[model samples]
Every structure is written in C-alpha cells, then in structure tokens.
Target chain A: MSETWKAFKPYALITPQTLVFLLFLVFPIVMIGVVSFWEFNGYSMTPAFTLANYQGIFTDVTLKTYLNTFKFLGLVWVATLLIGYPVAYFLAFHVPKLEWQILLFLVCTIPFWTSNIIRMISWVPLLGREGLVNQILMGIGLTQQPLEFLLYSDFAVVLGMVHLYIIFMIAPIFNSLMRIERSLITAAEDLGASGVQIFKEVILPLSAPGIAIGSIFIVTLVMGEFVTVRLMGGGQSASVGKLIQTQIGSLQYPLAAANAIVLLAVTMLIIVSILRVLDIRKEL
Target chain B: MQKRALSFYLLLAFFCLFVLFLYGPMITIFMLSLQGPDGALTFPMRGLSFYWLGQVFQEQRVGNFIEPFVRSLLLGATVMAITITASVLASMGFRQRFKGSTVIFYMTIASLIVPSILVSLGIGVVFQVMGWPTNWFSSGLGAHLTWTLPIAFLIMLGIFNRFDPSYEEAARDLGATDPKTFWEIVLPLIAPSLLGVGLLTFTLSYDEFTRTSLVSGQNNTLPLEIFGMTTNVTSPALYALGTLTTIFSASLILIAYFAYTAVVKRQRGKA
Candidate 1:
C-alpha cells in the first residue's frame, strides 16, 4: 500500500499539466505535421495527402519573400543588439543600487504594459504624412516633403520590435549582472584592474549567459515575427509569419502548417546551438 | 577627463532622444484621437470636440462595437484560468527530479521562443483538421491558451525554481499528507508567481493578434476588430478605440501589479 501510494503521488502531481500539454501543445504540433501534407481547395483543406503546398512555398515570389523575411530578421537582431547593449550596460553597471535598478527596469517595461497593437499603432500617427517626425523634419528643412519612407518601411518595423523587445534584453542582463558578486569586481580592482579592464575580463565573460538568453529570445522571436512585419512592412514584407497568416486567412492550412514546421525546425536548431554554447542548463 | 564628460553628455542625450523616439509617436496618436477630420490635426482656430469620441460610442457601426471588448475579456479570463492551472502543475512536475524532465523542460522553452505566427498557424491548422469547434467558448479559448501557456509556464517555473523545498519537507514531516503539504505550504510560497503569471497571461490573451487572427475564424477579439478597422477604414474612430483600449489595458496591468505586490508583501509578513 505504501509503495503504491508513493508511486501514485508523482503521477497524480504530473497528471493535470501533462494532460494539458498533450491536449494543447504536443498534440497540436503533431497535428500540424500531419495537416501540412493535405490538399487545400479554395475554402478548406481536403482529407488527402499532397506535396503541392510544400512545393508552392518554393516559388520565385515566395522565395523572394522568404529571403526578405530573413533579411528583416537579421536587421532587427543586429540593430536591437547594437542599441540594446549599451542601455543594458548602463543599467547593470552604471546604476548605483538595486532599488534604482529595479525602478529603471520598471520604466523600461511600462511601455510593454500596454497592448502591442496600441504600441505599434502609436507609430503610425507619429510617422504618418502629417505626423510629428515629418513636422520636425519639415521644420528643420531636412526634406522638401514629408518622408515617404517613414511609416510603411523596414525601419519602422525594426524600430517597433526593438522598442518592445529591449526590455527582454535588459531583464536578463540585469539578472546576470545582479548575480555577480560585488567582491569579484572589488577583487579585480584590488588587482589594479581599471573599469574597462574589469568589464572586458570579468563582467563581460560572466554576463555571457544573460547575453545568450537575450539573444536567443530576440533572434528567435524576430525570425518568427508577423505583427510588426505585417503592420510596419506594409503588406510588402512577406515574413514566414506573414506567409503563414496569409495561408491561414486564405484557407491554405496545409501550406501554413508546412511553413510553421520549417520555422519551428529553424528556431529549435538556433536554440539548441545557443544552448550548447551557453550551457544555460548548468546555470539553472 | 573631458572625453569622459563628453561621453556622459552624449549618453544622456542619446537616452533622452531614444525616450522621445520611443514614446513620441504614442503621444501624437493620443493627440490625434482628439482631433476631427479637417484642420483638427493642425493647430489654432478649431478647438477639440468630442466628435470622434462620440462617433466611436454612438454611431451604430462604431458605438455598438462592444462585442469585441466582451469577447476579449472573456478570452483573457479563460486563458488566465487555464494557464494558471497548467503552469502550476507543470512547475511542480518539473521541480521534481524525474526522468525526461530535461527534455520536457526544453520543449517548453522551445515554445517560448517560437514565433507567435508559426505556432498559431500550426495550431490553427491542427484544429481545423481535427474539426475543433471554433466557437467563442471553444476554439477561441483554446487559441488564447496556445499563446498564454508558454509564457505562464516559464514564469511559474522561474518562481518555483527559486522556492525553498524545505518548507514542503517540513510540512510533510509534521504529519501532513503530500497533497495537504502541497496545498497549504507549497502553494502559498508560489502564490506570488501565480499572480504574476495570471496578470501576464491575461494581458497577452487580451492583446493577442497573430494567433487569435488565425484560430479565431469568425470570432472578433479587440485586436481583430482593430485590424479590420485599420484595413477596412482608416478612420479616427479606430484611433479613439485604440486609445480607449490602451487605457483599459494599462489600468489592468497597474491593478494586477499592485494586487500581486500587496499579496506578496502580506505573505512575506506572515512568514
């Protein structure tokens, strides 16, 4: 009776979560794999297997779109890291205390407290033809007319993504930086290391874990992104996400599922590679 | 020394400029929402009127568009409940040193980073094939859960990972049964996380678009309504709606944060 009870406890504990996962997570993914091979008419998919959907994704137009999406992903990733790093650095090292640190961190996150749609729409009015950026530029005589490239451009998409995701970058770096013992820095100082030297040798090396975590999030999410790309990219940018949306919207479920599988595969590989490099499992 | 001062000034200037760059557009939208069709976007002479605001609330097409708000609220609440339950169980399960735990944990991590567009499409396709009813009380809730669960699980796990297990052990040693120890001792320790995850899950569900758009089928959440409004008619009423939604969302976030913080502080005091 004791042995049976002991075995039952863990099973009982895991039952609910495992059931949810099987119903919602694992099952859906398996179903996606199954559905991607089906045939789709105009309105709905047929219950028959076909590779036409996968082949359709390799068309010249889609290929171009796929390539553009990758380009956008690369741009967002590099830009976010370049801009986000220094701010994160300032927060981690330049900030004096934990209280102020948390306060500043809260400031960064407040914008995200609102809906993402609201945040993105906010960009439209500011960058629209009669918007503020144009007004400022016209006021300064920087352009003869309102900048046509302001609102519906890759620049806007990257700007919105970076603005929203900068918090993701900062949070992890802050967590890792906070974990570094003050004594380590003091010890480096005792050994006659300068601020830059300590940062380069000690701080940077140790904070790599956080950097890995942040980059994983930024890179992966940016790649799979649809909302920012679709909204700011002005229907011109066809990211994998947007493509998937188009498929689903037009009732091309099989194609969408295939695209999703490819995306999942790409992201899983990126995460696995990053995990190998960072060994984040050990940190936890 | 001069170079160092220059850098400091430059940093301050950059950060200030960035702040404006980040929020400048939002403020402009807020101002624009108050304006009417003509020179209201411009200055002087014409003053602000409640024209757009009235249009948003009174016009049958716009004013009566309260269904999405209700739908969003319903979806958000359902997602909150589902995610909280799933995350708590998953957290506890993962906490135990079990076989294949690493694999399960990694899979959950994968869900966190996978793009919303991708998983949403996959899930949508899966549901369509499986012929899951895309009704408000059925498919809508499931779609919302897909987006909410991963983040909720991550947050709950983060909290649970930091928990001191000795409390649970102590409860068990005190003649409390396993389930009793878990409910009375373990749950309280992780309650703060539950609240935080609930708040975030609710927020995500409420604002969710890509996933919602795919799986919603005919269901129109607030985000879906906004999408339609933006694409179909570039009316200022949309801006008014956006602003109102933003305020509603911001208030929810503030309330949830305060409630969670108060609970956490009180729990700590009791301890």
Candidate 2:
C-alpha cells in the first residue's frame, strides 16, 4: 500500500490541473482540428470528411489578409523594439538604485494589467478628427486640416498595437538586462570601449533571448489581432483574426477552424524558429 | 560622484515624454467622462459634471452594464479560486519529475500560445455540439481557465524553481510529517507568489475579451460589454464606463501589492 501510494502521489496531486488542461486546452484544440475536416452548411455542420474548408484558404482575399496581418506584425515588432529598448536600457543600467528601478518598472507595467479595450478606446479622444493631436497640429500651423490618417486607419491600428504591446517588450528586455553581470559592463568600459561599442558588443548580444521573447509576443498578438484592428482600424483594415471572426459570424465554423489551423501553423513556425535560437525555459 | 552626463538628462526628458505619451490619452478620456450633459467626445471642455458618468448606470440609455460588470467580478473570483488551488497542487507535484510531467509542461505552454479565437471557437463548437447550453460560467469559465491557468502555473514554476528546499528538509528531519512540513514550511514561504497568482488570474479573467466574446454565450463580460458600447455609443458615458473598470482593476492591483508586501515583511520578521 505504501509503495503504491508513493507511486501515485504526484499524479494524484496534479489531477485537478491536468483535468482542467485536458478538458479546456487539449480537448478544445483537438476538437478544432476535428471540426476543420467536417462539413458545414448554412444552419449546421455535419461530420462528413471534406477538404472544402481547407481549399477555401487559397482565395486572393485570404492571401491578401495574411499579407496585411504579417505587415502589421512586422511594423508593431519594429516599433515596440525601437521605442521600448531604450526605456528598458534606462531602467536596467541607468537607474541608480534597486527600489526605484522596481517602482518605476511597476509604473511601466501597471497599465498593462488594466482593461485592453479601455486602453484601445482611450486613443479616440486624442486621435479623432477634432481631437487633441489635431488641435495642437492646427494650432502650430503644421497642417490646416486634421490628418485623416490619425484615427480609424492603418496608422491608428499600428499606433494602438505599439501602445498595447510595448509592455511585453520592455518587461522581458528589462528582465534580461537585470540578469547581466554589472562587472562585465564595467570591464568593457575599463578596457577603453566607448559606450556605443560596449552596448553593441556586449549588451545587445546578451539581450537576444529577451528580444526573441518580446518579438514572439508582439508578432503573435498583432497577427491574431481582431479587437485591436476592429477598434483602432475602425473596420478599415483586414487581418487573419478578423477574417476568421467574420467566418464564424456567418456560421462558417469549418472554414474558421481551417483558418485557425493555418494561423496556428504560421505562428508556430515563427515561434519555433525563434526557439531554435534560444531555450525559453533556460532563460527564466 | 562624478558629474552626471548630458545623456542622463536627455534620457530623463525622453522618459518623461514617454510617460506622458503613455498616460495623456487615458487622462483625456477620464476627464472627458466627467463632461457635462452635452459634452462631445473630443475636447473644448463642455463644462465639468458627473452627468455623463451617471448616465452609464442608466441601462435604458446604454444597455445593461452593471450586470456584466458584477458578473465579470464573480467570474474572476471563481477562476481565482480554482487557479490558486490547482496551480499550487501542480507546482508541488512538479517538484519531482514524474510520469507525464513533460507532457503537462508543454501542454501548459501550448495553452498560452494557442490563439484566443481558437479556444473561443473550439469550446463554443464543442459545447454546442454536445447539446449543452454554453454559459458565462460553463464554457466561458473554461475558456478563461485556459488563459489564466497557464500564466499562474508558469509563475508558480518560477517561484518553485527558485525555492530553497533546505527548509522543508530541515522540517522533515525534525520529525515533522509531510503535511506538517508543507503547511509549516512551504506554504508560508510561497504565500507571496500565491498572492501574485491570485491577482493575475482575477485581473486576466476580468479583462479578457477575444476568448470570452464568442464563448460567453448569451451574456457579456465587462470587456465584452464595453466592446459592444464602442461601435454605436459615441458619448463620454463610454469613457465613464472605462474609467470605472480601470479604477476597479487598479485598486485590485494596489490591494494585491499591499498584501504581497505585508506577507514579505511578515516572513522577514519570522525569519
């Protein structure tokens, strides 16, 4: 009895979490894969094996949407990295004390915890035609008319994504930066390396895992984004996520599932490529 | 001691502008929510009052939000309970490599990586085909657990990876039983991480959108309700609702932080 009990302990302890995972995560994904092969009519679906849904993905519009979504992903990744890196650098190296570094880091991340929809909508008051940015632009004689691209355009979509997703960049980069030995940086400087050279040769290479982590986040999010494109693009943009959502809305479950599988494939392809460079488990 | 470089000042200015850039739009919306009865969505302040904020509570004007808000809070609490219990157990069980440990770890990571829409659609289809009435509590709850549980599990894993096991060994050496050792040594040591897991699960559940929109069945969560209001409702009342929900999330964060610090201080006192 004691031997059997010892053997069963870990599995028994993990039962609840494993159950939730199988029921919610693994089962649902498997069902999606199953449903992707089923046939769906206007009102309901049948369990007939059909390749019709997968064949639908070759349309020009779907290809265009995949291209558009990838474009947003690249744009947001570059913007978040360019803008968020310096902020992380400021926190990791320049901050004089640990407590202040932590406090300010919390300041950076606190907004991320709040409602994302609220954060997305918050842009409207400032980016709309009669909003503050336009008012200031007109006041300074930058332009006589409000920039139509400020809100409800691809510009707005990119801006909102950068705003929302930049947190993912800053947090991990800061984490990776915090783990770097200060002595290494000091040694580089003492060896007559310029600040730029020290950063280029030492800091940048070490932060690769962080950059990879942040890139995965930004890419996956922007690629699968429907809500951000919907709210910020204001229906002016097309995205893979939004296309899938539209399919589901029109009672096209099999088609949506097919798109989701392709989406999962593309996303996993990018992420696996990133993972080939770094072991995320080892980083944490 | 050396004179601070010009770079420091320049970086400080940039940081200030970034902070302003982060917060200015939010503040604009919050202030606009307080605009008088006739204020437009844009600026040129139409005088300040609580009229628009009050208008959010009037369901006849803005579809029912109070129920959704309250429902979201309840759902958050429910998810938090399960997440804390399950994540704690799983993390404990993970302290030793067992059968299927690798599978569970990958599944947890996969749970995080899978697109939210896939979860929403998958469960929605499963429940519909099962002849079950998908609900805010059933399928909705399951969808949310997939999002929150992996996060909580990962956090707990981080905490456990850094955990000092010497204390537990010492307790056991002192003739303490397994349950006693766990309760006396492990739980207190990990209380702060548990608090973090709690806060994360609750807030993520409360603010969830893409996953819940399709699976939440007939009713809406707070985020879904706010999303619906975005399209047609062009008033500061929407901003008022935003302000309220943001305040709710912020206060929860503040409360969690305070509790965390208190636990840390108490642990220090004991040590």
Candidate 3:
C-alpha cells in the first residue's frame, strides 16, 4: 500500500462507526442545545431565540423537583454503598473457591438484564396497603391498622432505586477489589497492621476508582429518572426528568429541550468531577 | 490459618441477604405468575395452574403483546449485527494512532451517559422537523444503537488490548491478501469476543425501554408494551410476561456462557 493509502486506511475503516456516532449521538445533542433557545408558543415552537424557557425553569416548582431528585440521589447513593461494599468485599476476599465466586457473581448480575419496569412494579404487591408487609405486620400485632405510608411514598421510591442500582455499585467495586494485589495485604499484615488499619490504609484507597465509577452510574441514573419516581412516588414527587416529560407531552418542545439541556449539564458536571477525582481511564 | 474468621461468617451472611434482596422479587413474581384462574395479583394463592400464562397470549387488555414482542426481537438482532460489525472495525482503526481518534472515543463515552429520555426527545423532534415518521426499524434502531454501540465499543477496546498483531502480519507474509487474512485469521481468533458482544447488544436492545419510548412511534416494543401494562393490567398475566422475558434473557446468558467456556478450553488446548 502507498503511504497516502495507508494513512487513509484507518479513516476508511472508521467511517461507518463515525457516521453513526455523528448522526445519532452528536447530532441529537446539538439539536437539543439548539432547540433549548428557541421560542415556544402555546401550539408550536418557532425558530426565534429566547431565554424564556430558561427563565421558566427558575421557579418554586422546578426548585422542589430538583430538591426532591437530590434527596433521592443522596439516600440511594449511601444505601447502595452500604449494601454493595460488603457484598463486593465478601465476593472478592472471602470466597474460597473460584467456581463458587463466579457463580455468585453471575447470580448478582442476572437481575440486571431483566426489565426495570417489571422489577419496579413487583414492589407493589409487597408494599401496598393490602400487601404482604401490611398483612405480616397486622398478623404479628405490630400495628393497629395497615400502614398507608408503606407504598406510594418517598420511602418506596428510594427502596426501588436502591434495589435497581445496587448491582451497578457491586460490579465495579468487586472488579477493582479483585484487581488489588494480594501481596499488598500480606505485606500490611506482616508489618503488624490490624484488620481495620489494613482496610483503611490499603483497601479503601485502592477501591476509590470503582466507587467513583459506581457513583457516576447511580447518581446520573437517579438524577434523570422519571419512571421510578412516577411509579413508586405515585405522582407525589417531581423530578427534572418528570418535568421534562410533562413538557414534551404538552408539545412544549422548547421548554422540554431547555429542561433536558440543564439536566444533561448537571449530570455531566457530576460525572466530570468524579472523573477528575480518579482517572477511571486507567481502571477501564 | 485455615480456620474461618468471625468476620468471614458475618460477611457471608451479608452476601446471602444481598443475593436474596436481588432475586426475591423476581422469584415472587415468578411464583405469582403460576397462580390459578381465581388468583389475585398478590400472595395468598388460590391454587397452582398455568391459567395466567395462557391469559398472556389471549388477552388484548395490554395491547397487542405479540406484535411488539416480534418487533423487539427483530430490532435486537439488527442492532446486535450492526454493533458487532461497527465495533470491530472501530477497534481495528483504534490500533493505529491517528488524529481525531481521541475526539471520537470521548464522543462514544458521552453517548453512554447522556439521559435516554433526552435522546428520545431530540430524535423525535428531529424526525418531526424533517417530515419523516419515526418507525421501529428506522428511528427505534437508531435510538437503540446510541445506547448499545457505546457499550459494544468499550468491550471491543478490552478485547483488542489483549489481541496480538503479529498473528495477522504472519498471515500476510504467507501470501494472504488483506481481506483473506482478516476473514481467515483475524476473525476466527476474535470470534469469542464477537459472540459475547452479540449477546450483550441483543439483550440491551431487547430490554431497552426508556430510549425507545418516544421514538418508537406507534409500534410498541416488548418493554414499551410492558410499561403500558404496569398502570392498568392487574393480574397474574403481567407476572407471566415478566417470567417469560426473564427466562428468555437467562437462556441467552447461559448459551453465551457455555460458548465462551468452550472457546477458552479449545484455545488452551491448542496453546
């Protein structure tokens, strides 16, 4: 091959992938950004640029929606970490056999492939007024009446989000934990390090990349979440994603696009900060 | 030293509970799916029968489930093929240090983290502006590709990192043409990763809901159909659909696992 052809060969090979990426990914994002500044009439959106959509988002309702989303994000993050860290640690460190470790790891991942909507709705029978939990509580004389607050509340929303996303935390943390060299821990032990000291000094720092990656997944998913909030919170809560969806439903494309752009910006900021803290590129 | 520590036991207990937490709802839904004709959506089963499973086929309450199920299957297969082909070519290009590669790589990653709803809205609006109707094979396939291709690219990056280039060079030196070398030597060696990618992209496309919601147009995919049913359909039949979809996905995972193990064993034997 000639030098020019050789130089062009790589570009030629990458053309199809690049085309798809540009047309679908980059173009849509650009479109959303452009649409965000346009004017929205009651019926249709016009091409005139305006800041009204952005101004509209600076309201008490939008503020409450954001506050509610952040509240859920904090709760879900802590819950998934508490549950995911121990499980990942156990699998990586305590499991004695390789086959058993793989088996259990696969078991944890199987639920991830199923439908998220189905899994979210499955909580209804367990947490509803006439559900199993209420029945068990009443049967055990734990309460005088069924707990109406068990389902269709903030508690239910957090439970659903944590359940759905805990595996995302476990997978990354377990991967990073497994990558840690056994010799490091052995060296710490030989130097008279206690269990807590070894974990705090050696294990925690090594797992920072995994935790950061997992936090990115959980936080972004919770921030842009609509279905879970609507289904579990039963319209009692509003999220930025839910607000955007409502705008889209009403054909208020400019406002929806503006809300979406803001959500994307906030999500990207959180992810970029996490990336800055730890270079996940090396881990990947 | 061989004796287990107290912390090990506590951690083991925690592991088991986490497993239960992950699988408990699924198992409960599967059991509820097996309820008899008189059974409600929740517990206290009337009796065990496959009546609800039968109801899923006959009932039109949740829209036409069969049509959407078929559409999802076809779309998944198409997305899987495109992802594998595009990712392989892209990974090969990545082997050479070229200008603009870093920009493309970051773009793929950006596609991965962008909210699915935003993509759907943007695509829907674009199609409307262009006077083109969104359809499953066109708009829906594009939406699914935006989600699946990024993941496929990441997996391909890992696959190519471990792949040696000397094998292909040897084939070329033996008088094999470029196409012939790629087809005979490069492909067979990387077949295992391709299969794994195929299975992953297929499952992702099949179970994709949020991205396909607005852009899927009038034709509903399985996930879309199931989402529609969640609000109104209150019977064991809904559980039956869940159980069925879970079974389909689990079977795909098992097949992929066996194929992967077999490939590894054969490679080890040759080595």
Please, what is the whole-model Cα lDDT of each candidate in the order they appear?
Answer: 0.74, 0.87, 0.87
lDDT for predicted candidate 1 compared with the true structure: 0.74
lDDT (tens digit, per residue) of candidate 2 on A1-284: 27777778889888999999899877888888999999988778999899999989999989999999999988898899998998998888888999889988888877888999999889988999998999999999999999999999988999998988899999889999999999998899889988888889999988888998888887677777898888888787999999989888887888998999999899999999988987666475
Residue pairs with backbone atoms closer than 3 Å in model 2 (clashes): none
| lDDT by residue for model 1 (B207-242), tens | 877666666767688888787676655566776777
Error of 1 at A223 (Å): 2.1
Interface RMSD score of each model: 2.4, 1.2, 1.1
Task: Write down the TM-score of model 3's second chain.
Answer: 0.96
Judged by whole-model lDDT over C-alpha atoms, candidate 2 comes out at 0.87
lDDT of 2 by residue, B1-271 (tens): 2433767777777777778878878898899999898898899889899998788788646687889989998999999999999998898899887988998888887888777888888888788678898899999999999999888988888889999999988998899987898888899789897887799789999999988888888888889988988888977889988998898888888888878888888888998
Question: Highest TM-score, which number?
Answer: 3
lDDT of 1 by residue, A93-162 (tens): 6677877777676667767767777788778767778777788888999998999878888788778788
Candidate 2's displacement at residue B21, Å, is: 2.2
Docking class of 3: medium
Instruction: Give the least accurate 10-residue stretch of model 1 chain B, judged by summed lDDT.
Output: B38-47
**How close is chain B to the truth by TM-score, in each candidate?**
0.87, 0.92, 0.96
Off by over 4 Å in 2: A1-3, A278-281, B1-4
